[model samples]
Target chain A: MNVIYTDNNATTQVAPEVLEEMLPYFSNQYGNPSSIHSFGGNVGKKIEEARSKIASLLGASSNEIVLTSCGTESDSTAILAALNSNPEKKHIVTTRVEHPAVKNLYEHLSRKGYRATFVPVDKDGNIDMEYLLKNLTGDTAMVSIMWANNETGVIFPIPEIAEEVKERGIVFHTDAVQAVGKIPINLAEVNVDMLSLSGHKLHAPKGVGVLYVRKGTKFSPFMIGGHQENGRRGGTENTASIIALGKAAELAAAHLDEENTRVKTLRDKLETELLKRVPNCIINGDRGNRLPNTTSIAFEYVEGESILMMMDQYGICASSGSACTSGSLEPSHVLRAMGVPFTAAHGSIRFSLSIYNTEEEIDFIIEKLPPIIERLRNMSPFWQEMKKKSA
Target chain B: MWDYTDKVKDHFLNPRNVGEIEDADGVGDVGSLACGDALKLFLKLDEHKRIKDAKFQTFGCASAIASSSALTEMIKGLTLEEAKKISNENIAEYLGGLPKEKMHCSVMGRDALEKAISHIKGEEEKKIEGEIVCECFGVTDREIERAVRENHLTSIKDVTDYVKAGGGCQNCHEKIQAIIDGILGVERPAKKEAPKLTNIQKIRLIEETLEREITPTLKKDGGDIALIDVDGDRVLVKLRGTCASCSKSELTLKHYVESKLRELVAPELEVEEVQ
Candidate 1:
């Protein structure tokens, strides 16, 4: 079975080059960077090299890069740190469509006496800037927004929102986990004070992430263990993973152009073909302004898990509206928030491509998916009854 | 992904007797588009009152499709009476047991079969006649109450799974819960109910508790729970959908809900894990 991975938004495979760069740190350069020996000195230099590479991707100073375990920790750190930094500011400004890494944390914080204003989004999953601006107040301590949504792939106007928040001197942070490699982001050009990225989202290993805390941003550490990460995070460095992340950053920067063109073509082809071949299908997000490689499609009258499982028989790995919240009978909250009816929302499937997905794979999916829908619809009581109702 | 039987996979991949049989002897269709999954089964009965051919079209997920496929396959050559005997459990068993969450897919299949049978009998569709309480799925107050009486539904969430009452918009959960309370006469607040001591009462209580609390939680998981029996406080229960025989069943039962039940009702209710 040829495995075609279309779940890049969930995580990406580690690129060979990134893995090659990390191997030595596990074996030869095994000394702790904090050690005062030649082996340690070599590891220390490599960590700095990695930090500089990561910093370049975000257009932030190298000193601002604080290594963390994963994107969630980075988000938890940034949000909680900002709240802790400003003790008197009780209000938090965020969007309703944020990843649970941000949304759940905000809700948790809200339960703890912190007032949260969850700004709503339009039907396209785009946050209303005017609503966000109207909600901001003197008591607002921070504005936590994401660069790109994981489900719908809708890109927020982060820089503009940041500029608006920055004018008021309110701390601004973005969970840019899905945006870093797929989009061009430079802290120098954008006014965002803090940003989070996950190594696994790119072609790097999991359990490795970076938080770019811009200079002059009031910051406090969420994890208070050691003097590591410049006393910003308190654990021993995940040395090997961090080194791999740096190499991945270099590859991401170099391959950005190819990814945008190549992956985008495959994605567009998949969406266009499925839309054309399958009747009653609709694209879920902002078509033109969203991620180049992400497409969320809702096949009317068919649930997502059935489509995904049938696709899996062909070794096509993708995600679905019903699959993520597998235990929760609810359809995708992201879709629900976008005002997509339950009929369509539960049937939505997300095909998130990376540079590795080929045209042949997309073609195979195009061939396989329609039959799956047809087959599922044939047994659908609702569709049968719907025809009866209509007739 | 759900653990579909090869039979289910085969049916899902190449469903038999697909599409609508136009101008058929009888057509039985149940569910609404808003119900997330629905089935319409068409039957052509022979002179002997046997179903010679059955075709179906469904609007749902994998299990729904497979269930419809399985239903058509199961009913071929069966007498009308024999076909009527086919239960949702029989259809699910034909597919080597469906995921509990996807069990509704099978239920949809059964509803379609019953409706088809009813249609052939010259009865108009048995639409639940009452006030439309659940605006999301158009479930009626009588329908919600009936599910409560038949399925022993204890909560609004259970009512949603059995009949898709409050699955959408969720504006009618309280209304559905009110129906369950009215029908079951469950006066103790779900949080304040005491655990039953006798076997039958314990079983009844377990069903009541599930109808009330566990169904909502399981419905949230794209699944549902049913009370099998009560061996003292050792409640023998069957898990469905993603939860059925799942690896996390213990954690889900022991830690998540059972702990809550212990805190609320009986501290000694032993929820034994069953297939």
Candidate 2:
């Protein structure tokens, strides 16, 4: 079956080029970057080169990049480092739409005596900038926000928020796992103190991530070990994945325009066709100011897991914000935060495109998805009542 | 990603007896849109009180739809009493099995059936069965107790799996656990004397035990395992992650895995490894 992969926000396929660049590091170049021996020292040089590639991608100095295990680790490192640096500050501010890496951590921190204010979002999945600005106080040690939401693909104004928070001398961080590769980010122009990004989201292998800490930012080690990553994040490097990430980052730099144009057109067509063909469905996020690759659509009276299963049979891969798939009793925090109604929230499906997605695949989904929704809606108990009432 | 059985996939892909039976003898609507899954069942009975026709309209995941379809299929041609005897487990069994978290889908099937039967019996709609326990899911205490009694659910998580009792904000987990303990305490004597676990029940127990009891511990040690097949008293499993490569993995299997399975699933069961 020809699998139409559209769940890039979940994780992406490792690009063949990225994978190729990484294979040599697994065995032939498997030496400790920390060791003083030339063989190991040669590996260290490759690490520096990889670091530069990542830094170049983000418009940052190589010294500012700290390699970690994954995005979650980078999130933990950034948030914890901010708090650890300013121990007196007892408050944290983050949006309700942050990925679990930040949101769950803030929740844990809330239980541990730190005051966490979860700023709300509008129905369009836009952050309530007023609430966020109002909540920033003298006691707030850190303000962590996501540059793009994983579920909704809603992009937050990271640079603007960063500037405001930095002006107030509050440590600012953004989980850019979704935004980094798909969007053009020249962090040298933004006032963010720290940024978190994962490798797998950008066609690199998993288990490797980067925490870009602005130079001279107050920091404490999350994984304290050997003097690796300039002691900001400490662990022996995930060499192959790190190398893969560098190549992926370089590719991302090259493909930024394609992401914005070709991928965006495919995404728009899927969104437009599905919305036109399907009834009682609405886009969950803002039509504008969202990541080019994502379209979160909610089909009322039908459930997301069923939609996904039917799509799976056609080799269509996507994700859902529905509670059934969430492994909880409530729908996604992102959707709920946006005040998306229960009718729509239960049926929300996020179709995230990538550079690999083709127009044929989009058209196939456009052709096939309407019937699936109609079938499920036909089986929905509410659909019967709704039709009867309308009649 | 739900690991739905092929039977479930078949039913979801091609659900049986869909749509409403207008002017039906009994109509039962259970669950709400807020809950993420809802079902409405329509039954037409023969003059002899046997189900002549059964149809359902369900709004839920694949398993929920499958479970509803399975219920409609299973209840047709059965007398009201025989149909009443069909439990949530029967609904799940009809589809081979459901993921533990998804057992509530089968419970939804059972709930819809009960509601339809109540309608046939002239029971009042919205007659609160018991005090609402899990405010989030709106699961009732009677429902929890009944699920526990029938399913032998041992923990708050089990209650959540069976009926979604504590699968929310978890504010009522303590109350749910209390209900579970109370039910288990009342049923302990009868349990020892009850019939031995059926193959389906035994497999469910082992899988639940693995998920609730053993998987977390193994995961803490950077390892995991999958139950391959159950052959009479022998349980086959494949160790994974750190456990797959560890020298003491065999010991881990015999001492940890076997003991845990024996304690929770069945005493006579043996653990074996398959390549």
Candidate 3:
């Protein structure tokens, strides 16, 4: 069996076209983009082109974007910038579901005498707007919310929240790593002040990301060194990766409509089939509004690792919400926050799709997974004896 | 994943003496749904106080299943004294050696066996003459000391690996350590504390906790819990009758079980849900 890659949310394999576009900067185009020479100036043009391509995707101007090494760096740059820009504002409002990249930073800030209000989410993984609104005060520096959650794929109401922050003259930022290519992002329409995105999430190379700093937002550079990214970000440009990210962004913009329709259908098909075939199975998050390519399922009884290992035996790859896999002694916080049972939490699997996934591949997995679950359940003393006791 | 030997896999895949023994002389059930695993051992004792037949049903992860299966196989045809002599080490050895993390699976098996023998001897509620060291699982100093003597356990964590002592909330961890230090005759070595339970032990603790705390609470609410299995630290269990579709408050079973197990056995045990 060909190994199916379903953990796209973790990090995607670089697209062939993106890699091809990046190959030149490793040798042929090695000049510093800021040098006075034509070779360096030519390198600068390519960077601008990539930046423009990225800008086109997000409905922002090329100059508004500042390239960074990764999503964390982008997030750190935006958040710390907002904090440092307004020393008087001591409070930061955020959601409970933000990735550790933001969560850890907020925690560190809290430790350093800054107050952070963590707004709660409902059982559906939706953040409470009223709670968020009530928490936003005069002392609030910024309202940083993830555009879409990494684990549950719950789409946060970014525009609604951003509009509220904008009215208060407070900064609004969003980590768009999981949302960039999966959803239609229009900064021109949304009231967000800053947005962070990673290249690897969209089949571009890792170690490259972009932070869109709205033209008039006050900012401070996170990486302090020689002037780069127009003095807004520091470090020698990851030229090849940036170009690849641009090409990948171009591809994403080109195929958005088709990929959205096709991938969502396949995701829905896999989810529906698995639910039908496997007993006591359930979908983790809301089905109506979510990423087109992600489907999380909870298999009641079997642990996620056992399911994942069996899936590996048949070359079906997926991610899990189990604590054992997450290096925590507990299951995924997203599932826990949603009041998912401990039994199902460890047994939960996330099947995240990409453009490359096919209906036949989904069918193959659907056809193969149920029996594996049944086999595991049959081996279970609880499952087998319970049936007998009940009968 | 646990580094389960072929023997462990064999026993887990084709577990010997599965199902129940009708009119069993004694049935000792331990572990729990919240603890992520549990075992119900059915025993038939001979006139000479020897185990004529031993069978088990486990609800937990792969290692717990293997441990229960291996344990049942180890006790059959052995005298009650011989079965009591079957330490977790002997069970692990019979399974060709479980991973350090998974050592608790075998330990749970041994605990179940001892409990079965104790029950057969009419000693379920009888307390031994030893100070309580691990309050989470009701493990006494004698139990920890015995585990050390039989298994040559060097550390408090090792004792937990073999007997699930000090595996839970760890309020009694210092007490467990004191017992271990006193038994090892080491002048208290001042060192940073170590987590008591291995990954597998954590799962057994969770099952033990669920059995001890969670299920009884559910039973009080007119519901019941049945453990499924312990795979690593993930426990699998099934809710019966009302618990299956009971009010959302049943979620408390998992938290109560996990916290109680972590409190009593080891902090690492996680309660997992099963169908």
Candidate 4:
């Protein structure tokens, strides 16, 4: 069975080019960059090159980029550094729809003597900017928000938000883990103080991430250890993955146009065809201001895990924001935060595409998915009740 | 992804009896859309009270649909009295075993079956027997206690996995713990004859009482307790962080700390502030 992988938001396939670029670092070039030997010193130069490539992709300075283990580390370092730099500020601001990386960290912070203000989102998953502005107080140490929602693929207005947050002297951070490669971001033009990007979200292997700290931003190290990442982040770098991330970043930059055009077209086609074929289904996010390669469709009355399982039978990989899929009692926080109806929230399926995805894959999914939804709906008591009510 | 059994996968992929029985003798619905899973069971009974046909319409995950399917198959030929003997464990065992978190799916099947049986007997639907313990899932104390006793659940998380009692806001965790303790017959305090206590013994008991009983309750409110000193019956302590800032720390110190110490150590034990 040919697997049609569409769960890119969860993680993407490591690009072959990225793997090839990283193999030498694991074997022949296996020198600790921290060592003073020439072999190690040469490896240090390669690390710098990788940093520059990643920096270029984000429109950031090479010195501003600090490589960490993953996006979660980058988020923790940024948020903690902001709070530590200004200890007098006891408050933090974030959106309610953040991925667990930011959401769970903020929840932990709230328990640890920090007042966290979770700004609400609209029904379309658009952030309430007025609520955000009102919550930005002198006591707010930082405002952390995501660039794009992983579940809904809804893009937040980061540039506008960053400018407003910066004007108030509040440190602004954006977890751009989902948006960095798929969307066009120029941190040179944006006023965000800190930005996080993960490797695996953009075709690089996992365990490598970049925290872009704007120049002149006050800093404190989260992982206090040996002077590495210029003491901004500590511990020996994940060398091979770092190199792979650099290659991935370069490819991402090159493929950015294709991502917006061809990938977006495929995603739109899949979403459109599914909606056309399947009745009583609704899209979960702002269709206009979303990532080019993602769609979250809720087949009302049917459960998401069942839909995902049925899709799995056909070798079509996807993900769900539903409760059963997450092992939680409620559906995805993103959907609930956006006030998606309970009827739809439990059945939301997210299809995130990547550059590797083809039109045939999308077509295959379009062909296979509607019947699955119809079958599940046929078995769903809620669906039957709904049909009767409508009748 | 859940590690579903092959039996579970087979049942889910090719679910049996997947529709409502028209003019059914008994019908039962359990769960809701808000809860992320629900099952509607329909039963057709013969003159001898044997199940002529059984069908289900389920809106849930693989295990839920599979459990519903399995239930219909299991109860098809059984008389109402025999069908009433089926348990959530029996349903789960039918499908090899459901993941612990997905155990509630099996429970849902059993609930629907019970309701269907009750409906056939023309009995009033079982009223929610106890106070609501988990507001998030609307799981009542009776429901939680029954699941705990039946499943032999040992932890709050296990109870949650079986019946979704303390799975939400978790404000009722302490209450759930009390209910579990009540069923398991584990005394919260060791009530042996009070032994003569050395200063060291008293201090150790105070620390143990604070760590075991008082700290967990305080920590739930984002507060903490520290044993500053233990001099005789007057257990001197300090509240930290949220506890220090909380205006109700006095009540916490008196009502919570003193009462716990009195019960666990001695009735005459007193707690006082060091700061």
**TM-score result, candidate 2:** 0.86
Instruction: Report model 2's chain A TM-score.
Output: 0.99
Where in model 4 is the C-alpha error above 4 Å? B189-275
lDDT of each: 0.83, 0.91, 0.82, 0.93
**Model 2: how far is A287 from its true place, Å?**
0.9
Better of 1 and 2 by lDDT: 2
Per-residue lDDT of A1-391 in model 2, one digit per residue for the tens? 9898999889999999998999988888999988899989888888888999999999999999999999999999999999989988999999888888998999999998899999999999899999999999999999999999898888999989998999999999999999998999998899999999999999999899999999999898988788888777767888888888989999999999999999999999998888899889999988898999999999998899999989998999999989888678789888998889999999999999999999999999999999999999999988877888999
Give per-candidate clash totals.
22, 0, 28, 0
Candidate 2 chain A, run of 10 with poorest lDDT: A226-235
Interface RMSD of each: 3.5, 0.8, 3.7, 0.7
Question: What are the per-residue Cα lDDT tens digits for candidate 3 across A1-391?
Answer: 6878888999998999998999999988998898889998888889999999999999999989999999999999999999888978999988887899999899899988899998888877888899999988999998899999888788988888898888998999999999999999999999888999999999998999999999989999999887989899878898899989999999999878866899889998999999998998888877877899998898876667667766777788888887435323347778877888876786789999999888889999999999988876765556766677879
If both were scored by TM-score, which would come out higher, candidate 2 or candidate 4?
A: 4
Docking quality of model 3: it rates as incorrect
lDDT score at residue A312, model 1, on the 0-100 scale: 82
- DockQ (C-alpha based) per candidate is 0.30, 0.61, 0.11, 0.67
Docking class of 4: medium
Candidate 2 residue A101 Cα shift, in angstroms, is 0.5
Cα misplacement distance, residue A202 of candidate 1 (Å)? 0.5
**TM-scores (chain A) of the candidates:** 0.98, 0.99, 0.97, 0.99
Report fnat for all candidates as fractions from 0 to 1.
0.66, 0.95, 0.12, 0.93
**TM-score of model 4 vs. true structure:** 0.88
Highest TM-score against the true fold, candidate: 4
